[model samples]
Target: MADFVKGLFGGQQPAKVAIPGDDDFADYAGAPEPTPAAISSYTDAAHLAQPTGALTARPYTAWYRVWERTSPEDFKLEMYILPFLFVLILVHVWGTRANRSKAKAWSKAHAPLLQQEFAQVGFREGEATSDDILREKKADEYSTYATGRQNVAFIDFKITLIKRFNPFMLLGEYLIPLFFESIPAPAERVEATAYVFDGNEAKHAPQYGSGDAKKVSNSSFDGFVFAIVHKDIMKRMREDRYDISLTTTRDHAKLPVWTAVMSESAEITDMMLTPELIKAIHDAGDSFEALIVTDQPIDQPKTLDDTKPKKRINLSLKLESTYTATLPLFQLFLRLPDHLATAAHFRPEALRRIKQTRDEQISKIRKLDDDEKAEERKVAADKQKRELRDQKLGRLSAEEQRKFLEKERERDSKKKMKRSTVKG
Candidate 1:
């Protein structure tokens, strides 16, 4: 105890004193004293141990031996990754090829029907190539288009198909519909048609309207057409809301319910919607989405200053079922341009009013363009003046800059006075 206390406080070293059971405790704990041979074996076996002396070169077979001894469980997940990716890629390629085959078959089947109507028919199979995408903005991989006749400016018939083996589509089309009854399953196929014809007398700006067929009680007005014209056109046609002159109640009694008429007078409507056309509408039923006679541009211009687009009559329809029987309806629409030009003759008064409306729209567009240009010029002029003033100030001394600012203020005041005097 005295020696332990002296060791803590005093500088002198104390004599060593071992515990009585220290050797027995070490033996019971099973920790043997390390030997020179045992230490040398441990150092040689450890692959990661640093050399105390010079570094020695290891044989290449040593690395191979270490790799062979590694557990297979270490790389179980990585082994499956490449094979799974290859299978996914193969499925995508098969789906794409199948889609193209279906499109080709559809085009082959429908080519004969188009040939019957057109003198020179051309069929082009749809592709998702970069060139096709660049040529047509709305290019689809699964769609095929046919062009017929020279008079017909454009014809686009698109058939959209479900992407085969697509996981996302499988989830939406099958699994989601099973869980949610209200959510309808996606259609396997959908078809849409657009026909554009060049016309000589279609001078109106963009105008749009839509209507549907409805049954009425009266025999005379069995399929009463409920027409809704564009709001702007409606406003111009009728000055007072209370007035019944432009009302659909009397004007569209003979036409199908929900058929839109864009004309100020009913003369154009009566000329276009003949008995045959009405019969076709009734016959086509719900399959017929619309048979529009529009002169609007298919693609809108970026600027009002762009050259006026050509005038044409456009007919658009969307059908869920096959449109083989609807070929006659297409022919009817094809003949509409000639029917309006030759068969239907408008009154001189009506022609003058229509021309006037077109001229007004042209003038309005021109005014807007001019205003935009004037604003741009004004901004440019202001910027130029600011830059010149800045340059001048940069060249001038502090005192000179002060005098220059004063002179500028005086010139502005004089200009304001001159403008006021002119007004007075």
Candidate 2:
């Protein structure tokens, strides 16, 4: 087309020009082709078969390799087994702990008794006042917290054993709370409060604790339970007043010296008074002037009426009628069974409740005693009656009532006839 265009222009076809070194067609003709580098890569593929760098396995295979990584000839069995064994042991320990916790939870599912028990032991949870300071101190001294904020304090309890020239102080007032062996809290305050045992339930049972068995003390002829209480009660003893004298019952007789009481306790439960203490009481005695009480000058109620009138002078030791008997009173009751203490310790309401239960037990025992006595009395009476009745009809069983009746009728008839003849 270019030559034809040139001929029409009268220029004839321009000569075709060829470059000196130019090829009109190259092999493959403009199609893309691989270079030598590509061919070499295919030929060099053999090198890729050998692992690169560390010659490491792929991740999954590497992880699986660890399970059987070592040969039996080189691997120590302990190394392989111990790690797994440790894991199993840890799991077992955790399981056991969990099971124990569950069991404890199940066991305590019904436990809501602490507050009630605190009330039982005379822990006053109510609002306390200055008058209660002594009580609070005593509670602080004696009360135990089982756990958390809960407290445990014993109530005032007393047992009256004997009727004598009444001793001024009861044993219960002097009884102290026992020292807890390993109490976890600190004692901020300590005081002793008067404890009186209600005797309404005194006839029931003695307070025989089942906590642990103890040896009987030969000196006191006391029971195992008494020993437990002895150590605790002895700690509460307060000495008599400075002015109180230990006067001798007999003139010039050697006084019973107060000796240190040897109670069976590693802690050395102290008896505050012995014969020596009595001597001290006497030696320290000072006469107190009696206050002259005038009724016209006094006996008026100031603001509130007190049931009892106050005197100008009151004795240091108060003697309330039927209030306290003495230490020996408790010793007397200590000889009784364990339930008596328990019976004595109960509150009036609680005592009433316990009475039904105790009565059931008492009823059985009482019947045995009553029945045996009744049987003996009946037998003796029957013999005595037979001797008297021998003059009347002679001895006979209850089954011979008809014969006795006939004999009685014959006698009555003879007597009536004689009386009728006398009248005529």
Best by TM-score: 1
Cα TM-score per model: 0.51, 0.18
Instruction: Give every collision pair in model 1.
Output: 211-258, 211-259, 212-257, 212-258, 224-257, 225-256, 225-257, 226-257, 226-258
The TM-score that candidate 1 achieves is 0.51
lDDT of 1 by residue, 48-147 (tens): 5766553666545756786787787877887889788888788777876666555555455455555555543444343233223112212123443444
lDDT of each: 0.50, 0.31
- Deviation in angstroms for 179 in model 2? 50
Across residues 355-409, which tens digit of lDDT does each residue of candidate 2 receive?
A: 4433444565567668888999999999998778775554566658677888889
Of the candidates shown, which would achieve the greatest lDDT relative to the real structure?
A: 1
The whole-model C-alpha lDDT of candidate 2 against the native structure comes to 0.31
Q: What's model 1's overall lDDT?
A: 0.50
